[model samples]
Target: MTRITRRLALGAAAATLAAPALRAQGTAIRIIVPFAPGGSTDAVARLVAPGLTQRLGAPVVVENRSGAAGAIGTDAVAKARPDGLTWLLTFDSHATLAALLPQLPFNPDRDLDPVMLIGGAPYVLACKPDKPFRSITDVVDAARARPDAVSFGSTGNGTIGHLTMVLLQGRTNTRITHLPYRSGGLAVNDTVAGHTDMMIGSAAVVHPHARSGTLRTFAQFGPQRLPALSDLPTVAEAGLAGLEAEAWWGVFAPHGTPQDAVSRMNAALKESLNEERVRATMQEVQQARLVASSPGELATFLAREVAKWGEVVRANNIRAD
Candidate 1:
């Protein structure tokens, strides 16, 4: 081969090899949901994937890597290559796990870059329909009258339901017996069966039971009352003015991912959230409100959540059981 022809061929080979690196769009983007399929996190990832694919002009897919209370999949994202191709879609437990489990493999705050706050739904404190308690005030009065006698069911220790109850007990200065179950369904069932006096769970989980006359929802934990559950007042309106808790979801990329890539991903996320179909799916199916927040806003929110939940975990001596 002639030297000129050989040089040209080599140049072409180099360009071909470098094409993936030179391109702004990744070959594919995988959203790692740290839970099983059909879970809220997984649903959110799938709901947003199509819009993200359209916006970023690349294939987007969801991968479930559930285990160890989300630590396994979350660690996968934390240790993934910082090429902006892999991200995490997780719930509020992401912030509380670190405090509950002392030996996590990855540092949630330092190992992942915040992408967006996504959104969350208020938790509902409901009781058996036969229970006499009419409001949170009634429940508190009963609890104050009989400390540790009034029991509440929660999904598990260190879960949102459990921790929120911890915060409630702290704020109310009441000592209620807590019965942690293996699943939210079990907790709700127990509450409905009247085995437990009350339970604090997500609106999605308790709303149907409440509608069916199995459970009586007293209040929802949010800054304001939920329109669908208009009869149930807000936690603040129920007399705990400063208490606001919810089951939130967010997106995060591996730390040190390029700023431009992060920005592009965030924009795609915002666009996906604004899409009519995505909004309807999230609200109607997942019962989650959409929050299209900037990366900076997500970072701030994550910091606050981590700190706030961490305090609750420590103060209550909560552990993952």
Candidate 2:
């Protein structure tokens, strides 16, 4: 082949190879959800994937890598390249993981950079209609009256819901049986089927059943009452000493990822979150409100969460199960 022709072919090949480097939009983006599919974390990632694809002109994929209470997938993202190709969509358990697993491989604070604080939904405690409990006060009274007779179910052993109950028990000097289910659905089903006396879970898990009249929600573990559960009282009003817990969701990138990439991803996330479809799904399916916060804000929120839940875990002697 002629020198000029060979040189032209090589130039074209170089440009093709450099395309992905020059324009990040040319390659696919992978969003790692550190949980199983169908949960709020995975659903939100999948819901926002199309928006990321639209805004960045790149294919966005949501992959569920569930294990070790989300450490496996999260660690994968933490150790990933900072090329903006990998990200983590995690749940509230993220903060507690550090305190629960002292030997955690990656430092959540230093190994991963927050991209966005999607939103949070408060935990709600509910019971079957047949139960004599009418409010948080009634539940407390029942637990006091019969220490181990009043059973409460949660999603898992070390979940925020579980800790919330533990906090309540500690503050109230009550002893209620804790029935940890493998999944929220199972817990909710048992509560509805009268197998369990009561249950604690996120608004996402309990709201629908409450709305459907299968469960009677009494107390919301948040600062204020939710619009949907407006009639329900908050723990503060129940005189629980400001006991509040919310299940939250967020996005993160491997630490040391370029600021430009972080900003770009944050912007795309904001835009996607604003989409009516996304907002509707979050509220209806996940019972989550949209915060759509900046990276700095997310960082601050994450730090507070880690500290708060770490204290809870350590104080209660809770561990991953």
Candidate 3:
């Protein structure tokens, strides 16, 4: 009859009511890829889906809901029930969404919880083989000379590739027009066809053309050069000291999922990254490295990336329009 006793009874009843719902789901998990199939995000998700399915003792399915620059699929995951069954496999660009769009259906920081950071691929600054630019400085000098005439293409606006070029332009105080394509393939194709002056895109996506001499790689966007393209210098080494950016992916679940579930997902992903087949597949694609990080680490990393890209976006006056 006492207040304290009543409060304790209510707490116990709530726990009892919640237990069965949690127990009923067990371990069945779904991983959502925001982009279409065959891209890096899909590839990364498929690579670990089987291992996760085995480790969690449940089937893991990869669902692609590609559209609206990844907003459609990401919003689906954010609005899903926070029971840990639905997870999102996305890239670092998700953080930029909040800054890019005038309005967003979901708050990435509030509606999603970090599960793990999968890995990243460096972006390569490349040009047509016959183009006069041979290095980052060469491109900078050309842009300086031509002003907005030196055009650069990216997968799309707000993509890592777009932002990387923005950062480069900001640092070197040069101007370059932007051509945003729906995919990296399109942008790279245009650049190779001499339709665009340059392109900053994923190494894996651009490496083949560069190797074939159709495209010439001037520099890589990362703290260090990638082994697959060791001859190319890092942007810093190429004379841009602070310009480092890359396409990175991570896993996240809807907010309010149990901490234990997040931990299990992180552990499973980490194990998957260590698998020889996974490593080989990533390397074959020219992905720089597979970094399996803890959930907390991923959360911190997302926060930092958001701030970093926000500065670049604002400074460059980049708007979705």
Candidate 4:
């Protein structure tokens, strides 16, 4: 594998499934986000739940079951009955958790079935507005000057944000103390409250804060600049070549779920994502490009992510906290 070649799995998602099952009618459908509320994962779940409720003729509920870098809640969905009523909406951490927790209770690949690849967004590294940072050079210099004295917060230990910062520190030969939180919102709050020197999170979590002047962004962890953030510099542009990392979100159902149920859920998801408000919110508010993908495509992408990030976890000697 040349640099573990990978790409976002996407396909011409069929707008309508062969047969839309009415199994969920009048039943309360639960969409479980395996992270704390106020984060991107929770946001995406809530955004689509209403539309899903309408489309499926069921009362959709979003639930937060946060802990253990998303493994606890994920494991819940992994072991849930394949009734199509219980689904999981997860973050980038989902792909990397198995690499961190070897004794993870559930087989991420075998226990849960992919429903959709919601989308991906670049990680944004930023500091509080009052911090002394004009560019990535200053941040790097500070970290080099005091090594682990400079601290950065992330959603959790094995989250892509945390690993991305780890990769950044390694590439720059710096040591910043890792401060992992239960969720992205908590991390952002503490960073803004002057509890941490810097923070890195998905565009969905950090973009709004940066725009509001609560935090000052320096480097975007994307290969190129996005339309919404054209003014910001890419990590590569900051002189750290090949330092790209994008946080992704997706939906999944318990393994052994009926094919008809999966197809019906997928169709509802595609329709919910196609809504104009959802499209604009995803692209503008979250700064995340949406990829409402087919189930097969999401499965392929999940496999690729597991392979790629698992290597990073081992190479970095990343242990779960």
Candidate 5:
């Protein structure tokens, strides 16, 4: 071939390779929440979607692909085209599931790239108002005294709430029976009805019951006490240090998404998390703490969380069944 013709062919090949990157810049983005609508993951995704849409100049949609302990929707995001148009907004459970479930269709760390950490809320240990326990120590004492008699309810067997209880048992050296329910709402319902001894869940879910005196607040699983629920002490303050578990949510895109798009999304998320309405709504819904983090920070956080929960799951022998 002539040199001029060969050079033209090389230029055409480079442009062809760049075409996908250009197309990705103009596509609408879809944030997939691997759980049912109206949950924390979905709520956070919706809250941030508008801002992202505005920032990226593309329609941002939040889709709920709930089921299989969140594996179903997560797999969907993992298998989606790596063109940066589709993403996943889920909680720490996604990371835990990667470590706990050997059959996960997609490897969270390998198949997905972290975008941003939206925010999180500490799990509150609450009980029926009429229950005898008044503090974390009291609950521990009772669990120690009664063994399997003191049972706690959670969203499901392998959920963060369930694992939080497992960590509690491991730390306190107490045995408390777990009563898994279909959802956090159901678990909270039973806790309020006195059917379950107590429940560990997001502050948003338990705050209303505690305010209404249907459930009594014992302790929160966070680094520090929440502002709205200042009357309640943290697990550490209640004499159990180093026990912090927050229901964290974050955004992730399929691996191989352009770095430019990831950076843009991260910037938008950081801005959205700081918005007054977003903060207020999160507080109103679930008393969640607003934490916007960069992609690298979120990746490190997820890795650490995966390791932390892996130990808890192994020690507790917790499973999906």
Candidate 6:
């Protein structure tokens, strides 16, 4: 054969060999949301699933496998075949589960490959509108004066909301009672009903009441205050500098997944995040910002979160079991 003909023949053979791998990458994608449907994490997963399907040219499905503060489904994805077919859509809890529930079936860092940091939003601390607490300063003052008289409700024990309070207590050298609820909505409800003195959670969970005048927002726990709530002060701005605590979500796949598959999914996710509908749903409905970060960036972020929260968990002796 001529030199050109030989080169063409070799290229065709290589293409044939790569055909199976390409097909595998196109297989239906299963996204595992480690929380119940209708929550923010599920919202993010469902919001992006259709766009992912369009971009990757394969059906995308989001399955809720809720339990153990998202450890069950996360473990399932961690143990899944690393063919990139299965992925985990999890919230900030993914990084702290190891510290909270030491009995987790899988090591989040070791068993899963970071795909992307989808997005994050800071939690807000709110109180009953009629309560005397008007700001973070008032809350801290009252808590310090009355000790455990200022009770706070959290989504649950060992959750970000709860830990943020613990961190606050350590920072201000104050005492506050912690009331753990099964869900953030319920926690917010109790606070609004005057059953709890205060509650801290995402805007979706706690801000609506503030807007409605049912609950009063005392402070937001983020690096900077959100423009929508620009009048409100951040926890740092209020008094506690360096006390920013943002709840973040991210996607992960089983370790050993092919880099090609990871890259394809990552690209699809980035595109989906940029979709107008997806962005609107996250911003308006779920109250989260879109953070489409690379796999390496996500890995670094997760490590930092794990270390930061792990210290709080250890110091406070927080545990799920």
The best candidate by lDDT is 4
Lowest summed lDDT across 10 adjacent residues in model 3 is found at 18-27
Model 5 weakest 10-residue run by lDDT: 17-26
Residue 11 Cα positional deviation in candidate 1, in Å, after optimal superposition: 20
Q: Rank the candidates by lDDT, best first.
A: 4, 2, 6, 1, 3, 5
Clashes of each: 0, 0, 0, 0, 1, 0
lDDT of 5 at 293: 87
lDDT of 5 by residue, 212-258 (tens): 77888888998988888888899888778988888888888999988
How much is 199 displaced in model 5, in angstroms?
Answer: 1.2
Clashes of 1: 0
Candidate with the greatest TM-score versus the true structure: 4
lDDT scores in order: 0.82, 0.85, 0.81, 0.87, 0.81, 0.83
After TM-score superposition, the amount by which residue 106's alpha carbon in candidate 4 deviates from its true location, in angstroms, is 0.7
The segments of candidate 1 whose C-alpha lies over 4 angstroms from its true place after superposition are: 1-28, 36-39, 57-59, 128-133, 141-151, 179-197, 208-215, 284-287
TM-score of 2: 0.85
- Per-residue lDDT of model 3, residues 88-200, tens digit only: 99876787888887588898889999888877888888999888878888888888988999998876778778888877777889989999876566777899999998888
Query: Which residue pairs in candidate 6 have backbone atoms (N, alpha carbon, C) closer than 3 angstroms, thus clashing?
Result: none
Winner of 1 and 2 under TM-score: 2
**Residue by residue across 1-321, what tens digits does model 6's lDDT show?**
999999999999999856644675647789999876655677678889999888776789999887777788888998999976899988887778989888778888789999999888889888887889878999888988899999999766777878998889989999999997655666777888999998988876665667778888879998888766788899888768998888888999999998878998899898888888878867866667777999999999988998998888888888862
Q: Estimate each model's TM-score.
A: 0.78, 0.85, 0.83, 0.92, 0.83, 0.85
Model 4 Cα lDDT, one tens digit per residue, 1-321: 343343222222332332243445567988999889988888888988999998888899999999999998998999999988899999988888888999999998889998899899999888898988767788889999998988999998888888888888888999999999999899999999989998998888898998899998878998899888888899888789988889899989999998878888898998998899998998898888889899999989988889888888988878777
Which residue ranges in model 5 land beyond 4 Å of their true spot?
1-28, 212-214, 283-285
Estimate the TM-score for candidate 4: 0.92
Q: Between the candidate structures 2 and 3, which one is better when assessed by TM-score?
A: 2
| Candidate 6 lDDT trough over 10 residues, lowest sum | 17-26
Cα lDDT tens digits, model 1, 149-260, are 9999875677777888888888999999989765456777789789999988777667767877889888888878777787788888867888878888889999999887
